[model samples]
Target: MIENTSSVNRVAVAILIAACLFMLVPLAVAFVTATLDYPTFLRGGVTIIPGTHFFDNVIEVWQLTRLPRQIFNSFVTALGISLGKMFLAFTTAYALVFFRSRYTIFIYAAVLATIMLPLELMIVTLYQVTANIAEPVNWIANIGGLWARYFGDPLGLKLSLLDTYPGIILPQIATGGAILIMVQFMRTLPRDLARAATMDGASPLRFMFDVVLPLSKGPLIALTLFFFVDGWGKFMWPLIAASSPDMITGVVGLTRLDFGEEAAIPNYPLKMTGAFMVSIVPLVIIAVFQRRIVRGLTYMDR
Candidate 1:
C-alpha cells in the first residue's frame, strides 16, 4: 500500500503537463509553419498561428520531389531491418539462454561487447565491406599465395552491395541491445516451463515456437515498431550507401528539397511541409500502437 499526498499528486501532474508541452510545442510550431504559404511565411517567420496552405505546400512538394518513391524505399528498408533484427535477436537469445554450455556466457559477453561499438564508429570499414562483400572470400582463396602460384595471379572477386536494399538493411540488423533484452526476458521464465515441455516430449524448436514465441509476442511487437522507426529515420548510412536519389530513404530525400535560389530566401514552409510528410507514417504507427508499445516495453502483461 502507498500513500499519495494531494500536493505531491498536483505537482506531479503539473510536471507531466509541462513535459508534454515541451515536447509538443516544437512539433506544433513545425506543423503551423508547414501550413503557411511562402509569402505568409516570409512575412511572419515561424509563427505559432496556423495557415490554410498546408495542402498546397504538400501538393507542391509531392509534385516537385521524389518523396513518394523514397517513402516506399524507406518502408521496404525499415520492414526488412525490423524482421531481420527480430529473427536474429530471438534465435540468438534463445540459444544463449536455453542451451547451457561452458562457452555460453562467453558468447553472451561477446555479443554484449558489441553494444559499445556502434555502426557510426566503424562506418568507414563497414563501407569497405559493403563495397566488396567478396573481399573476405578472395583473401581466403589466395591465402599463403597458393591461388597466385596455381593460377599465375591472385584470386580476384567483386560483389558489391552498395545502393541495394540488402546493403542498407544488412549492416544494421545485428543489434546487441535487442539480444540483451530478449536474453534478460527469457531468463525470467520459470525453469518448470522447459521441464514441462521436455516431459511432453517436445523438441527444442517446438518449445521455442509454441511456448516462447507466444509469450514473446509483446516484446517482439514493441521491438518491431522501435526498429521500424529507427530504420525509417536513418539518414547518414542511407545517404552514403545510395548513390542515386531513387534509392535514398525518406529522411535523406527530405534534404534534397532546396528552395534557395540566387539572392532568394530559403523556403522554410515547404521544407517543414516535406518534414511533416516524411514523419507522418511513423507518427501514425506510434499513435496506433502506443498502448502495446508501453505494455511490451514494461512487460506489463507478463
Candidate 2:
C-alpha cells in the first residue's frame, strides 16, 4: 500500500524549494549589482550578468574603511561574545539543573525573562552605563589613593570599556536563548547518571566537567554554530557601543557604505561588495557546521 503521508511530504518539499528560490533572489541581486558599474546600476535596478569591475569594486570596499581592521575587530567581538554567552549559559544551566534550591526556578525564570526585553529597549540605558564605567573604577581608585596616603603608593587603574572589545562583548553577552537550550537538553539527561557520578566522589564541578560536558557535545556544537551566526551578524549594539573608528566592527562598516556624493545617490555596487564580504564569516561557519547545527538543534528531549 502507498504511504498516506506522501502527499504531505510532497507539499512540504514544494514549499521548501519555493522558499529557497525566494531567498536566493536577493543574493542574486547582490551578486549582479556587486559586479556592475555605477552607470549600469543606475540605469538598471540590478544587472543580470557579471561585469568586469567585480575585482575593482571589491578593492574599493576594502580600502574605504580599512576592511581588514574591521574584519579583525568583528571577529574578536563575535568570538568573545559567543564564548562568553556559552560559558555563562552553561554555568547557569548547571546551577539550575543539578543543584536544587528554593529560588532555583525563580532565578531561571528571571534570566529567561530577559528574552522579552531585547537590547533595543535598553540601548539608551546600556549606552549610559558603558559610557560611565570609569566612574566606579575612579571611585575605587580614590579609596585606594586615600589608603596609599597612609600606606604605600596607591595603585591607580582607570577602567572604561567604551569603544573597547570587552565593552562590545560584555553588553551583548547575555545568553538567555543559550541558557534555555542547555536547560532543555539537561532535563533530558538521566538524573541517576549525575547521582552516580556524585556517589563516585565527583564534585559538582567535576561532574559537570567530566560528565555533563561530554554528553553535551551535540548541543554545544549546535549552540556554537548558532551563536557564531548571531554574534557575527550583531549590528546595533556594536554600532552604539563602539563609536570610535578604531574599534568599529565590520557590520558597523556596512552601515556607512550606503552613502555616496549625495543623499539621493548611493554606491550600490560598492555597498553590495561590502555587504558580501561582511557575510563571508557567517556563511563559512554555516557551511562547515551546517550538519552539526541540525543535529544539535534536534537533539533536545532525545
Which is the leading candidate under TM-score?
1
Give the Cα error of residue 9 in candidate 2, in Å. 4.5
Model 1, residue 78: what's the lDDT? 96
lDDT of 1 by residue, 1-302 (tens): 87869999899999999999998898899999999998887787888679999999999888888888899999999999999999999999999989989999899999999999998998999899999999999999999999999899999999999999999999999989999988988988898999999999999999999999999998989988988988899888898889788898989988887664453688888889999999999999999988888888777755
Give me the runs in candidate 2 sitting further than 4 Å from their true place: 1-10, 39-45, 134-159, 258-264, 300-302
Task: Please name the candidate that would achieve the greatest lDDT relative to the true structure.
Answer: 1
Task: State the C-alpha lDDT per candidate.
Answer: 0.91, 0.83
What TM-score does prediction 2 earn? 0.85
Clashing pairs in 1: none
Tens-digit lDDT track of model 2 for 48-127:
78888888888877776566688788899888888888888888898899887999989999999999989889998888
What TM-score, to 2 decimals, does candidate 1 have?
0.93
Candidate 2: Cα lDDT at 276 = 88
